[model samples]
Target: MTAKVENRDFTADLNNKSSKAFQDFEREFKQQMAELYQSITSYRGVEIHSLRNGSVIVNYTVLLEVPATATANSTVQGISAELVTIVNSYLNCCQSNPACGLCFNASFTEVTSAKADSVDEDLCDGQVPEGFEDYYSPALTALGVLCVTVCDKRAASPYRCVHGTCSVERSGPRCECSERAAFWYLDGSCASRLSKLGVAVGVPVAALAVAAAAFAAFLLRARRQNLEYR
Candidate 1:
């Protein structure tokens, strides 16, 4: 991340304080990296160049390492999402210390390397985890670090949905079946049609049974009237 000092007039302070500033910077940077990987680590390399508009450009690599919980896809996405805040907090460490007052604008980029190579968008076979409920964050996908899922690449197309549309959602692939017709399972099978057919057959059979009962009652009444006349 880059931090541009807000005040341009503090050149003397810039020269005098830069050494101590960056020393503290390095400490904080290493600390954040350790928190991530649980080991003492710093950036792989850094390059500092002065800008014409009283800004210092610091280019650095995060020096990726395999995390202990590297298999957790959410953790992978988290590091990618939170690294900027980590760097910014490091730059703004002076904020917590009013005696060393300075403000900076932070900007950074993510480099996909190391353990992030295993980021599967169809993680856990596309089953949504608890609490998240059908909403997988698009952070890894947006970062371009995604190992695209089968559905994502349309490899799972020609979907099983006979009467529905299939879509690749943030939660993974989904089927939206037409409710006006028979109910469709989430997996896109029209199994509900059989149930509807059963109900349709049952209605006529029930009506015929009722009609036969009424006719038997009518015949019994006629026989009683005939006996009365006799």
Candidate 2:
């Protein structure tokens, strides 16, 4: 299915130390974020960027199946406001709870026209973007993203992580090359930063070398067998 990209921008700063607080919110509000995301109609995926000064820039991009039936301007406005509301509510919840110890001033940065389209609907819906199921938390009781990074095919390339998935736990997007890490996320998908280039190159070369060695061994065995029979 063809999809469109709609970006709603917002910025917020941490109330506590930047590093720990960011991680805490990601862990604590993960489920809330997932649920809040579902409220949007053509829910594609989200990307968040961290700045040097501790303020964060969030990019929530949706891939609409077709051109929006509603006017693009109004749709952008409505969706942007909805996102801000969702984030603010989550932050407020954090404030009330001491364990979270998180606070941030969030406000809209810009609302883009909802005209961005992609035939590759997987864009920003995570690495395996064909289905909606890959985007959210799996367990009903606990909270977490199914994939580390969701790609907006229009903006970033799909991750080909060998070991770990793309995660957004740090300053920028990187591949996570750890064991048993299923899917990677971009905006928050920082499990590891190893490139697909390495894997794409390494595996085949290793296999070819093994195959050549095996072939040489088979030839040597056949030659010995023929000599003995003669």
Candidate 3:
């Protein structure tokens, strides 16, 4: 999760160059790092460090604190595997696309693998594949948001229900009810049809009560009139 950029000589006159170039580089670098940070943080959650020697290091440390209920040991392994897939995918895209403007092609080669459970471990271990920068720069920038999305979804670990709905497996995969059905939560389960049935029965019973009360009142008024006539 860590990326290091060594000092590149923009020109011989590091001090004389228009402070503008340095400023621009700094701005762009920070922006890129921010994007990377956002992507990883959404997945494993992370800590970032920038060294004065022109090195940027990212640590995926948040996985350690995941609640036991939210994610188990198997889920952690799955998350780690998925992160490696995403990072490799980003690296591949950057290596293939030259116009991405990500200058550190060499750095892509250094990121080899990632471990979500261990904060101190180097995910890539400075062994990125060849041509990773050219393919991964634009890919990483464009799909960085997706990395977070996929990670979040995976953390939830929803599955396609048999009925074509999305269901999350807490204890086990359970169906997500369609909104078209009358929905209710009962006894740790969702009951979808009860609301409609309840309404159907309640409306008729209410009408019967009103009609019976009106009939009794009418009968009482008729008897009182006959007594008055007598």
The model with the greatest TM-score is 2
lDDT of 1 by residue, 68-186 (tens): 33254555455545555654454534644534434444553343332344444456344544533333432233233332333343232333555555565556566566654543243
Candidate 2 deviant stretches above 4 angstroms: 1-30, 49-52, 55-77, 89-91, 96-98, 106-114, 118-230
**CA shift of 14, model 2, Å:** 13
**For residues 205-229, what per-residue lDDT tens digits would candidate 2 score against the true structure?**
9999999999999999999999999
lDDT of 3 by residue, 50-90 (tens): 22233322222333333323234455565555444444344
Model 2 lDDT, full chain set: 0.45
> Of the candidates numbered 2 and 3, which has the greater TM-score value?
2
Better of 1 and 2 by TM-score: 2
Q: For each candidate, C-alpha RMSD in Å?
A: 13.4, 22.8, 17.9
Model 1 spans > 4 angstroms off: 1-191, 195-204, 220-230
Clash pairs (backbone) in predicted model 1: none
